[model samples]
Target: MISLRKLAPALCLGVALQGTTAMAEEVLFYHDKGFWSEALAKVGDASEAATGVKIAESPYSSAEQYKAFVQSSIASGKAPEMFSWWGGQSLNDLVATGKIAPLDDVWKTAIDSGDFPASTADLFSVDGKPYGLPMHIGKWAVLFNKDIFAEVGVEAPATWADLEMVAEKLKAAGHTPFAATVQDGWRGFIWFQELLLRTNPDAYAKIHTGELAYDSDEIREVFQLWSELFAKGWFTDVRSNREIEDFAAGGAGMYLIGDWAIGLLESNNLPIVKMGAFVMPNVDASIPPAVIVEGSPIVFSTEAGQDEAYIKAAEYWMSADGANVWGAASGNSIGNVNAEAPNEILSSLDASINEMGASAVLRWWELVPAQLQGELVAEFNSFMLDPTMEQAEAVMANIQALNAEYWADQ
Candidate 1:
């Protein structure tokens, strides 16, 4: 096991705080990129201070790498004592391995103490047993450049017609109505997921989990809408950076992304006032609006030697202080109701959720089974790269085939 001291001096406090034994028994925490410096580090320091247990954090540079590392480690019977993961299907899959420890005791304490709400707790559970604690929450929306919108003389869209009108206006003004990329297959997922939710969020959930067919009329409607958007030339270069140059340079009028991008946008020197975000409009007026919410979780391993230390670390990470630190650093809304949002962007997200009463659907990245997710992304990429009625139908058929094969085993 790697020690925290070897990583950095700031993280080395674990040794001096409780001596060699506690440092040796340190809680090894692994997470994906975006949390290494400001977010998770702060939580690590706070956890060590509160529990006298050193936390050695190892952050992988990408989600793919992190997932691979954890899976391989677990297979080798050497997974970290605690590690970050996505909720929903991702957490359930980890639970199936029988290596993850249930945090029902810690969850009960957090709920009673008001550190977390029941809704957030339920998100990280499988079959009523809690498996992890949320590290941060993200609400997905359309982030537009205020300058570009002003130039086009259009406001944020609130309905499907309004969205179409705004798109036409932007295009007429010689700007891409939307910015997206298919070079990386996952980029296509943002559009597909939003369209699904806009069509029927309940059906979206059911289809992803295999309770409904992916090629059904409901899902076909989603693709038809997406195809229409493509036919109208609503999207920009699929290869450009979605959050940075593409939207920031006014090449694309709008960018659909999660709240986590707010920090990235702000860091790019775009003034907060110039960036505006809104919930994606529903496809039909009769359907209520809903937003996809994604939360990262930290799950614990049930390995014999590290249960107590893992529990302490999980407690600290799930507490109000940890959420506050994480929120302030990541600029993403947190699941802990008691924790305050760090910036205006996050504040707006929280307000929108409450105002719209949006039903939380797990984002596409984490909600789908890993292999099925890859297949879905591949199909979406194929359709976007050369969108046509023929391509859309083929993609739908492919999805049905993939879903049938994948779900049959489960």
Candidate 2:
């Protein structure tokens, strides 16, 4: 059997769990808190019992923290045998390090065994080479309180005008129509991306890739509409961290969050029956409806010797059993064909994605080039905190400047 220690001499020793010895072959698995730690512990126990390979489970509190840890640890050859990550440009960084092994063979076997459909395998592929196993698919939409909408005499809006009308009614009824926050930086992109894509999906794509300027009229319109919401007092406090709680506590009429956040409400024993999710309204009636899609995946570490034990552990984690275990705990939809989303909202999202055609855009949070992600987040957050035409223009100008510099260097 190949030994990881011998393969990477500088690996951080603490990466190994407390009881693991140099001679004992154990596969370390790391992920963000989306997968409840206890559920992972159960999966690890089951994997070990069936394969006789120890699976050490480690989890970080959030995606940002997980990314930071992975970035620092990879330099020391301390990346786990397999770890969860976002696909697209986020995975590009690790792939560039020459420390992430391609999972083409694993994909082929998985498809052959009927564990995943050939089409599903494409989610984990980069440049036609599979590099990870998809763990969950999250759809971005507005999760609204049914009772609050009804109480305000407003149904879920189907068009931009309808949405504006509903927001007016909700505000008149003394309710914040939307729960919003800019403190996390990433949260600021949700509305901006949604509005831009709804306005013109193709233009949104072009703008992100630098084919269109960030300060273009189309982009500015998104800010104008978003500012209107803030101007009407239809939004919660700009930095409110209690969005989920506010939505659940009847303090906010709706929340524009990912489907994954349903797990948070469910775990907190929120009134699930009162909540319903809907794709945001199209800003232009002429444009097609679009929804943002995000994928969570697990990538194999090259430094972790790809021996029989490590391979088996990774395969088992990506298997139907493992997917089901994760779905049951995380309230996330598993990519495995045999596994289904644990809730109705996710099932509805899956069906919509199949029907939406060109309307499903890859999430901007991870789709943008890594070098410009932080800058874009900061720029967007700045506008969200102070939603004004001046602030919006300045933010877009700054983003365009950064965009030009980064692409020029590229």
Candidate 3:
């Protein structure tokens, strides 16, 4: 095994030390996070100890500002050594700028060593070259209140019919079957994607690539199911900011979100013992199981990748040891398959997903063409607030129009 620390000093060449003392050279890391600052700092400490390169973080509270700053910095040839970024079209755009470095070698190393699954590399790849390492790989599941399930005399559903039965029972017990919201705008697609995937996974994947029309029969069926759920009053107010809190307090029976939200639950003081997660059952049982997976990648600037020290540090960060340190600090699962899960709930969820042979579908927000994301999300938000058949029809038409315009331009 090659050691990063052994090669660090020679690779760091002209890099300045912290003081006159033999301190590790520091590299700037940019990310959009006001809440995870401390957690990231801890990860940085571990990186320095392992790689002989101090990882200094610069966090931004406003995502818009953070994106603008990063873009401008890259354009000015002053991009940070490393930065957190999204995958799919967003990453494609960054790679097209010729500023981001392709980390194919780093990816091959991790994949061959069994630290990460080869499928995960697809998330950060464009033209078959990966440009980043996974920061977080989130699996979407229905997080239910264990106490509420027990009170309703129900267990996690195994089939679509059982899911509806569980929901009806919870509703009868004066509990909302699920918590949902469109408050952040981007969240509107959560249920939309989940329901669509459960109903027609092929259509779900096809729609993102423009191979399936949004206004087709397959999509209409999804919207019809969504309307019926809303008509049954089984979901929380879409405008409410307390969706997670309501689920935590047992006011809502379940919340469908990425496992990364486990951190949010913990931050709100929700007891892990009260929480349980299950893969959303397939509405079309004939199809194989699937779960939405989202990834955040740490990308390197082209300039930074030229530095041997930065390359060594990136390699270290992709290893099981580095990923486990990050997982421990962030209270979330890292992409490394060899690393232990952050908590028992996540561990159980991972095992369940693997045991069932579920397919990992990318989340809609990142999977869809970037050009259409905002407009389509706005349409979804509108439909969530007015979940009528009429609104669903109109939203479908509007979304199809936007989708067509984007594909036409392409």
Best by TM-score: 3
Q: Over 4 Å off in model 3, which ranges?
A: 1-20, 62-65, 75-80, 108-114, 117-119
Q: lDDT per prediction?
A: 0.77, 0.76, 0.83
Error of 2 at 23 (Å): 13
Residue 143, candidate 2: alpha-carbon lDDT = 84
Q: Report the C-alpha lDDT of model 1 over 177-252, residue by residue, as the tens digit.
A: 8888874346678898888888787787797778998778898888888888888899886655454655665678
1-410, model 3: which lDDT tens digit per residue? 11123326644453454334454656777898656777778877887888777667789876567878988988997676789988878889888888888898888889999888897888888898889888788889999989899998999999999999999999999999999988655788998899999888889889988899999999999999999999998899899877666666676898999887777777677877888999999998998998888888899988777777677778877888887887777667767878877888888998899999998888998888876777898999999999998999999999999999888877
| lDDT for position 90 in model 3 | 84
Number of colliding residue pairs in each model: 1, 0, 0
Every model's TM-score: 0.86, 0.87, 0.88
Ranking by lDDT: 3, 1, 2
Candidate achieving the largest lDDT: 3
TM-score for predicted model 1 compared with the true structure: 0.86
Span of ten consecutive residues with least summed lDDT in model 1: 1-10
Cα distance off (Å), candidate 3, residue 89 = 2.6
